[model samples]
Target: MHLRIIALALTAVLTSCAGVQVHRVTDRNQPGIRYWRPAPYLALVETRTENAVACEVRPLMLPDKTEEYAITINAGLGSVKATPTLTDGWNLVSLNAEADSKTSENLTALATLLKTGAEIKARGVTKPPTQPVPTCRGVFRVDYDAAGNFKGFSRISL
Candidate 1:
């Protein structure tokens, strides 16, 4: 009876771990490139610089598997979404900057107000605030096999 209980507990822990297993594969040729396989059909590539971080989500299986989507997060700015294009790949979706510290403070204040049921005022500004041009620190081109398995990634110029 005691052995049965221990067996059940062990099985539960192993099953949970399997569901959250992530494989990190590094390429010897490209030392800078990093790969993470979070799921069977999805792979994530990330590269970081002093002031910025970039990530790309490459689908292993898709009708047009050659495409890749990338996003960059700047220290001063929030997240910038990019879409792949034939001519200029990974075009910025928006031009918005969020001051990290100030944004966090504002969010905390807003959450406090909501908890207290305080009235909030909404203001509209005519002109959109201009932000500095976002720099592309590192861009990569991910390769996959015919069977939809990730081969590796190579650094590409913007």
Candidate 2:
């Protein structure tokens, strides 16, 4: 009976933590093509045990002067708000759209730095460039651990 209670309690605690949070954050510091407005990027945050364990950002489609942009999250496991089933290893969480033109440019520059063996920073987050920056049509694959912590991202082939 005591073991059952302990298992239930642990399950409840784990359930509360297994999810993903996504939002758009505007980076006014990054240069925009218009020279007056900074571009926006999507911030993907992973939570485990109700605490954010990892974060990554990707550029969104640039908004034209006359159009409004809205960001949405679509996960492979269902809504990002849904609790994910615990597994023994990593799971693919979300598949995001391709990099925008501005992002492509920034990524190209970062790739150059990588070739030189220099560290690179993307939107203030410094990490080594993993794979070649995808073109505007390439899709992004985001993965997470069993505990809902972000693992990393990979580009899907066209």
Candidate 3:
């Protein structure tokens, strides 16, 4: 009975978002009693800068999969939705960033660092806002220039 109410509430929330489409991604990679959906995209943006490529990630996935949530990004030039993936070990998931010969290492480092931070936060070394309820959070949007250079990132929270 409780599960049904939760499912109904989630459906109602997801049904209310705009633009971005939502799809179910099951873990054919893993098996057993579990499941997860990242979040809905509220908006996306694409912009450029000299030293860093910044994507203003808006609302993003809650670390705890059981809650209803969404993610967004602000790219001045605009943005596109990418295929989603299971964000390893975190128990949350993420969207893939465009691959680039120009900035892959930097982007990869940024991503890795952030993921480490999230993991640490979840572990309670640093009391994060989500600390009260440690969750699997993923950074929402990634930035790539016209040349496909990944520059920076922003993770989703709540």
Which candidate has the highest TM-score of all? Answer: 3
Prediction RMSDs, each to the true structure? 21.7, 24.0, 22.1
Which of 1 and 2 is ahead in lDDT?
A: 2
lDDT for every model?
0.33, 0.34, 0.38
- Model 2 alpha-carbon miss at residue 115, Å: 46
Q: Determine the C-alpha RMSD for candidate 2 after optimal superposition of all C-alphas.
A: 24.0
- Across 1-158, the per-residue lDDT of candidate 1 in tens digits comes to 99999999877643332111111223334321122211113334567899988754444321222222222222322332222122122221222223223344335433542332221111111222222213333433444579755565544454
lDDT computed for candidate 3:
0.38
Encode model 2's per-residue lDDT on 43-123: one tens digit a residue: 343434665453444544222233221222223222233222212222212223332233233344334423322211121
Error of 1 at 83 (Å): 21
Candidate with more favorable, higher lDDT: 2 or 3: 3
Candidate 3 backbone collisions, by pair: 45-75, 46-75, 46-77, 46-78, 63-135, 63-136, 139-155
